[model samples]
Target: MSVALDGVGFVHANGHRALTGISLSAGAGERLAVIGPSGAGKTTLMRVLGAALHPVEGRVAVLDVDPWKLSPSALRKLRARIATVHQAPPIAPRLRVVTAVLSGRLGEWTLPRAIASLLHPSDIAGAHEALTRVSLQDRLFDRCDRLSGGQLQRVGVARAMYQRPALLLADEPVSALDPTLADATLRELVAQSEATGATFIASLHAVDLALHWFPRIVGMREGRVVFDRPRDEVTQEMLTALYANEHTAQGAADSAVPMHLAVCRA
Candidate 1:
């Protein structure tokens, strides 16, 4: 398995429980999308799978290594093989786009080389190649501060693609984009994973996008897995049940479509 979680659980420092009793596994080249209403532990689940947050209970293995069991340096090495595209890009405002994209290799480069790349990006061609996939090659030398929120999000995706990790986890990576750009960016991400044989997993708020893009759908609710099914098997009834909540029922109802039609259209 490229990514595995068994009985995983997490709680914030302030004592808010985020996830509980989650178990999942995905092999290389598999595409999975997680969908649910806001605050349904989707982000928490991504953090766990990305090895950014060690589970307080159970285990998480990425590319066959138990992340928490590794030493600090070893953990860094493991994380280099797992790329996480966050909702926020986390790039410095003043950094050049090329420099930001090139940072993807910092984990694999020597300390001196990494520092040098920050001062003068060595792999301009590689950075351009990555940005081209997202249709941002022209902005390669622009300051990150000059970009819009959605553009920054695309830069993040490009960086992850540049890293070429064995496992890719994205937490609402397209949340900042319009429908058109969002669809295009998702196509790029899914294509990259397939072409490289990497496992791709994303948590998205758009039910239609999730249903259309991924073959496997994992529905989450209240910090737990409501259903994990093949796309064809996911029905509107299942979606309604998965997203049913006092405040969000209407919103969920608006998003839910006939699963069979979604597949056909996709």
Candidate 2:
């Protein structure tokens, strides 16, 4: 399995629980989408899978290594094989696109080489190749600050591609993109994972895109997995339930299908 979480649970420093009993597994080359409303623990799940956050009460094996159990250097090595694209692209404002893309290999490169590469990007061709996949090669020399939110998101995708990771995790990757651009970007991400036989998992609020692109769908609600099923098997009823709020007057029980969640059947 590329990722495995056994009874995972996470709590914030503020004593708020973000996830509970998140037992899930995904194999290599599998494409899965996590769909949920805001504060549904979707981002927390992504962080746990990417090994960026350790669960307080469960075991996690990413790329066959338990990140929390490994030595510092060993954990870093394990993390090098995993790539995560955040909702916001974490690129420096003054950094050129090429430099940001090349930063994907900083984990693999030596300290001296990495420092030199940052000063003078020696992998221009490689960076350009990655950018071209996301149709952002024209912005290779542009500073990150000059790019729009969607463009910056695409740069994050390009960097993930350059990493050639065994596991790719994206959190709301297409939130800033238009419908057409979102579709294209998702296609590019899936294509890269398919070509490399890497595990691809994305947390998305767009249910239509998730159903259209991913074969497997995992629904999250209130820090729990509401349902995990094939795309074809996910029903509008499930979606309504997944997005239900007990505090609201219009709960899932009152929600009608083929209306608000018509896209699930599409």
Candidate 3:
């Protein structure tokens, strides 16, 4: 298995319980999507899976090893095999695109080489090649601050690609992109995952896109796994119920598929 979690739970610093009793497992070379409403703990769940946040309860085993049990060096080495693309990539604004993409290797590079990369990007061609997958090769040298939101999102994806990780995790990776670009980018990610036989998982709010792209669908709500089943088994009724409280919390339960979701699904 690429990932295994048993009775995982997490709490925020502010005393909010973000996840509870979340058990999930994914096999190598499998592609899955996590779909949930806002504040449903999707992001928190991804953080736990990525080893960025240790679960306060239960166990987490990625690539068949427990991350929290590993030594510091071993943990870093294990993390190098896993890559994450954040919802809002925490990249420096002033850094050039190529530099940001090359940062993916910081986990694997040596001390001297890592520092040297900050001074001068060590592999311009490699960065460019990764960016090419997202059609951002033309902006390889541009400052990150100069790019639009959608472009920055793509840059994050490119960096993940450059990492060549065994386990890939993405949090709303195409949220800022237009419909066409979002579809194209997701197709690209799936293609690469298939080529490399990497375990790919993404958290998305777009129900249609998640259903169309992934074979396995995991639905989350109130920090719990409401359903874990094959994509074809996910019904419209299930989606409606999953997002029920999200809309009802505001006021009405608008039965229509959300406009924000359609923006990417189209």
Q: TM-score per candidate, in order?
A: 0.95, 0.92, 0.92
lDDT of 2 by residue, 56-77 (tens): 9989999987899899999899
Give the C-alpha lDDT of model 2. Answer: 0.87
Q: What lDDT would candidate 3 get against the real structure?
A: 0.88
Instruction: For candidate 1, give the lDDT of residue 189.
Output: 93
Highest lDDT: which candidate? 1
C-alpha positional error of residue 50 in candidate 1 after TM-score superposition, expressed in Å:
0.9
Show model 2 residue runs off by greater than 4 Å. 245-266
Instruction: For model 1, give the RMSD to the true fold.
Output: 1.7
* Candidates ranked, most accurate by lDDT first: 1, 3, 2
- Clashes per candidate (backbone, < 3 Å): 0, 0, 0
TM-score of 3: 0.92
* Candidate topping TM-score: 1
Clashing pairs in 2: none
* lDDT for each residue of candidate 3 in 1-266, tens digit (9 for 90 to 100): 99999999999999999999999999999999998889999999998989889999999999999999999999999999998988799999999999999999899999999989988999999999999999999999999999999999999999999998999999999999987898889898898789899999999887767766888889999999999988766666777788886764222113323422334231
